[model samples]
Target: MVGVSKRVEAPSQGNREFTMTYANFAHIRDIAYDLTGITLSDHKQNMIYGRLARRLRALGLSSFDDYCNLLSEDSPELHEFINAITTNLTAFFRENHHFDFLKTTAFPNIIRKNMASKRLRIWSAGCSTGEEPYSIAMTLSATAGFSQWNAKILATDLDSNVVDKGRRGIYQEDRCTGIPNEYTRYLKRNPSTGEIKIREDVQEKIAFKQLNLLHQWPMKGPFDIIFCRNVVIYFDQETQKKLFARYHKMLAEGGYLFIGHSENLNRVSNDFTSLGKTMYQKK
Candidate 1:
């Protein structure tokens, strides 16, 4: 939730001795891409320094070179370093309209048309910390009579740590604030631990996996719906185009693709026809 601002000057050339350098920027960019498939542009020079500088100080490393060397050491510290730099901001029902659309339009249509199939598959791409996929499961359970139907939600993220956390199905109360009251009733609150955990039935419907969008997709899918919202902002235009194309291939005929409000397929790809306002149906 921290805002990343533009850097006024380069760390090495600027008057400030503690500024980030070109070498540091390159190292951090490569590390980010290698670990999370997120490409840090030159504009993110300050962001790289701001997010990692404190870690460097804590590790007693005074220079970017030393920090980079530390990252290359292949220790648990290196894994922590990668986890700290990757952004994992997410909340339940963060974008409610997408869920509403899925419940009212997509799910109903899929159920009626695929009655013979008797199975539904939904993919929550970039499912940060589980909220998105959990929301999907809740929607299906409430609207689609989950007990009678066979349904599975595949939730994936590039960050292994967050993926593990999501699989645990535990969340802070504040994170569940926007969740519907009905859904809230299903969440179990443990007095001893003061942690809220998702109900077992809902958790069982979702399978969490670690996935890198930039790399080759491992799962075979002709998914009915793919919720890849709010993740492409970090990618370049070419990457975005390629990703959308891949999504087009992954989606089944008449399958739906939901992207972030800030993203569009207008310039990215023509394989998907716009379904109005951040929604798309594969052509």
Candidate 2:
């Protein structure tokens, strides 16, 4: 049960602040957990308040209770709510070392072993805005004879907004700064607006879709690599355990898993062994 209070209190601003009591905040947190498997701690109160405040105005609702009621009553609105609250902070070659390993070791080994099949399968789970999958595409495109192989990357996120952006394969020119010089071949420049784009060839290798990791996955996989980096950090221990188990099942034996630098599987999982940094190998 959420903590329901009689008195509604809003933080004071110049005019009016969003009214969110501890009870309402608790309910929101619970819904987020139930829907997306993300555990929002108490400290995220201000963040939740700030973001959902806009939703309240858009819906013409005055109270957090009304918003929570709408959430229970409506399904489509829940999707919008999830899209709004989810954090999507990603960039090209983020935590670059993982991609380095892929270019130097994993991809080469997998490609060599799979040369006859001429197929490469990679999944960028929780791939926000497509940078990670685009990075995967560039890594393959940079490697020797990558075109000979039928490479594919499955990029997915819970946020439909970010997934659509990734599918568009366009980014502000400044956002492409972190791309390495060797892999710059995969980017094209639009002189009209100076926007940077993932080359169509590279873009073709990826499929962007909206997915919630807690839910059932539609695609069957024996993927060579999976990047769930900076994603499960928000999940509870049990949720992380289940997800890692699913990742283990989805991966080929000795396949790679790349997680956030701060994340670990020490206590939560035994299906994977650390290969240093945030990389893990299925055991």
TM-scores vs. true structure, each candidate: 0.87, 0.94
User: Can you write out model 1's per-residue Cα lDDT over 67-145, one digit (the tens) per residue?
Assistant: 7777774666666676677778788987788888878999888988788877888999999899989988888888854
Candidate 2: C-alpha lDDT: 0.88
Q: What's the lDDT for all of these models? A: 0.82, 0.88
Model 1 regions lying over 4 Å from their true place: 1-8, 11-19, 31-37, 54-60, 70-81
Candidate 2, poorest ten consecutive residues by summed lDDT: 1-10
Assess the local accuracy of residue 75 in candidate 2 as a C-alpha lDDT between 0 and 100: 69
Which candidate comes out best when scored by TM-score?
2
lDDT of 1 at 48: 73
